[model samples]
Target: MIYAIGAVVGLIGGIKVYNKFSSGDPDTSKTAASWFGACIFLIVAATILRSFFL
Candidate 1:
């Protein structure tokens, strides 16, 4: 379930980054980094919660 959510978020982020890249946006790298961080944070948080609760 958590992974499924992560996949969705990844797909959305990928599309957003691609758009930014195609448009030659100056902050594209920053956007990508933030999105990547969000995905990683989600995974890590889920893992920590599962380990603590289950």
Candidate 2:
């Protein structure tokens, strides 16, 4: 559940980063990268948690 929340937060952050970069607002490449990392981490964690719990 915590991992899922992390993923959702990461998704929202990534979307914000994408929108900024694509709209000529700012680069935000680092933020996007961090968000990507967070998303991947959460996904893996969630998968592992599920495997262990269910």
Candidate 3:
């Protein structure tokens, strides 16, 4: 359940990040990259934890 929650959060976060980047100036590339990375990391971490424990 925790892992699923993490994935859902990540998915929603990633979509928001994408929208932010799309509607803003290109000068914020670094900020967008970090946010996108964080979303990916959350999903990956959740997958790893779930696989290890369940």
Candidate 4:
């Protein structure tokens, strides 16, 4: 349940980050990739931590 919640949050955050960074006519692909990667990392970390500790 906690992991699910964390994943949802991460997905929402990732979408927001992607939108925020992917705007305008610039080279935002890298920025969006990094943000999405960070979001995935957060989700995985949260799931692992919750499963092991809580």
Candidate 5:
């Protein structure tokens, strides 16, 4: 379930990044980094929580 959510978030982030890139947005790198960070945070948080609970 956690991974599924992550995948969905990643897909959304990918599309947003791709759109920014195609439109030549100057802040695209920052946006991409933030999105990537969010996804990684989610995965790490889930792992930590699962370890604590199970």
Candidate 6:
């Protein structure tokens, strides 16, 4: 369900952050930022929908 999607977003964010701080291109920071945003959106949307549905 939505929780699964949200978890995926979180994992993506973690990978992005790790990449940005570890061995990724410095110019790819924006990609990491986008992942952070996606994680926020997924968590918020999931929370709202979960609240509504259950």
Q: Best lDDT goes to which candidate?
A: 5
TM-scores across all candidates?
A: 0.94, 0.59, 0.55, 0.52, 0.96, 0.58
Model 4 per-residue lDDT tens digits across residues 1-54: 655765676777667666766676365677667756866777778778878987
**Runs with alpha carbons beyond 4 Å of true place in candidate 2:** 1-7, 19-27
Model 4: weakest 10-residue lDDT segment is 23-32
Candidate 5, residues 18-48: lDDT per residue as tens digits? Answer: 9999999999999999999999999999999
Model 4 regions lying over 4 Å from their true place = 1-25
Candidate 3 lDDT over 1-54, as tens digits, reads: 665766676777677667777888564667656767876777788789878988
Clashes of each: 0, 0, 0, 0, 0, 0
Better of 2 and 5 by TM-score: 5
Candidate 6 lDDT (Cα, 0 to 1): 0.78
Q: Cα miss at 26, model 3 (Å)?
A: 6.0
**Could you arrange the candidates by TM-score from highest to lowest?**
5, 1, 2, 6, 3, 4
Candidate 5 lDDT score relative to the true structure: 0.96
Q: Candidate 4 at residue 32, lDDT? A: 60
Model 5 spans with C-alpha error above 4 angstroms: none
lDDT of each model, Cα atoms only? 0.94, 0.82, 0.71, 0.69, 0.96, 0.78
Off by over 4 Å in 1: none
Identify the candidate with maximal TM-score. 5
- Lowest lDDT 10-mer window, candidate 1? 1-10
lDDT of 2 by residue, 1-54 (tens): 777698679879977997888887756887787888888888888889889988
Error of 5 at 17 (Å): 0.4
Candidate 3 has an lDDT of: 0.71
- Report the candidate with higher lDDT, 1 versus 2: 1
